[model samples]
Target: MWSGDELDLDAYLARIGYDIGRDGELAPDVRTLTALHRAHVAAIPFENLDVALGRQVPLDLKSLQGKLVDRRRGGYCYEQNSLLAAALERIGFQVAGRGARNRSRGATLPPVTHAVLAVTIDGEQWLADAGFGWQGVLEPVPLRAGARVEQSGWTFGIGVEDEGIHVLRSLRPEGWTDLYAFSPQTLYPGDFTVMNHYSSSHPQSRFLGQVVAQRPGADVRRALVRETLSSVRADGSAEERIVDTADLAVTLEAEFGIELDSEERARLERLHAAGV
Candidate 1:
């Protein structure tokens, strides 16, 4: 089920700094679920550097483990969420994938390019996502309408929409802002592969021509897209500053906790110089 047995559970727990699971008490209960979600978000970052480098984003559990776990690299929604799903399933949690449309971009509805997870505990489903990058919930959000939760002083909520869709929103100083909208329809690993193709190679894909990395921190969220670095405080105030190519690697490591090898670093800097 979801290639759980193929995952290196102990390695994953250590990667995310989750000790409770190390002693083998890692339950499929909500407490462990929430803790795992929180730790994973803080440890593994969200990034699209590989796609920007014109590489394929693999979704298999083996490739996911190699890049995200062994290599200590960050990935976008599909890779991040898939790794999480494998860990959850390995621990006996019922997990399913859901496709989501990114709404934070603007009024126009984006495609269902995002991947998320739904976990069931005692018949109650919870929204557990670790791949949403900058505007993601730090804990497992209830999979119900009008459900709200406060995580690390940051607030989040779920709202209902037309056609039984569920929208994930964050509470900002100005008001609630939509992060993404997802339907209850469960997606499979194969579905994610198809979407990944478009995201990695499609000419019109946002990730195709630029670098994107994000860290959703409690006090402030950080997003590094292409040549710009944006920080949004919990109070809703924000700042955007251009990141010089020379400082890109440092910014990625210091802000998003991502470090690339020398060749990869040189390639990224070249991509930047080439106006990507």
Candidate 2:
């Protein structure tokens, strides 16, 4: 029941790259969720391209849409999920911000590290995620247990964990694997920014350490840096590519719609060379 003023519709739509006047009505059923999910995946990519290049990424609504929807840039969890929350709310859907786990290398349980969305439509609550790096959910899944929901060649399930926490899982041929956990709590921008700062700045931060891998889907893409490695899948197989310093600027602009100046470019090159 979080209430903010009705968002500025036209500006928001333009920012997200949808022409508003033509499509006055948005489908409100499962189809609506599916369409939005597709548009999000196709339009907004899961990338730390900017951060890796030593750029500052803001999570405010104006900046989020301005980059993704307006300027045609992509972003990480906070940027993608925040703008999505705004879009859903503007179109009369109930949405809340929430946090999710960032799986650790040796831990049995996933660690909380990113932001996501909880949406309620037609009295049924669902988890809506647009920023999970490579393994993100591509469709809305019901907020109930023992039910398998399919999304972009992946299946999801919800189950109750200890302490009454809700766990989200991805189903593979082997079995079910935990993705993240959360209570039925609503988060605000400040909440996400705190986590964002930690992930972006900490020395142990994976993003800062090396190149990371992320693919929105099959035929989409993947990235590999000196310290990071990633594979993208469009048809469910991995597509891996290595980018060099020579390709960095063009890749950011062409792949993520980010514009960098000469000084920013020099700084990014230095950071890439330093690998810190």
Compare the candidates by TM-score and give the number of the best one: 1
Question: Which lDDT tens digits does candidate 2 get at residues 1-276?
Answer: 222243465665555455535544564565676567656765666667566665577777766656676666667788777777777776678788887765423255545677888888789888888888656677777777665777656667888767656777776565777777887777887898888887777766667744343445634445545534456543445544556777766765665555667886677766666765
List lDDT for all candidates, in order: 0.89, 0.66
- Per lDDT, the best of the predicted structures is 1
| TM-score (all chains, Cα) for each model | 0.96, 0.80
Worst 10 residues of 2 by lDDT: 1-10
Q: Model 1 — TM-score against the truth?
A: 0.96
Question: Residue 3 of candidate 1: its Cα lDDT?
Answer: 95
Candidate 1: Cα lDDT at 219: 84
How close is each model in CA RMSD to the real structure? 1.5, 3.4
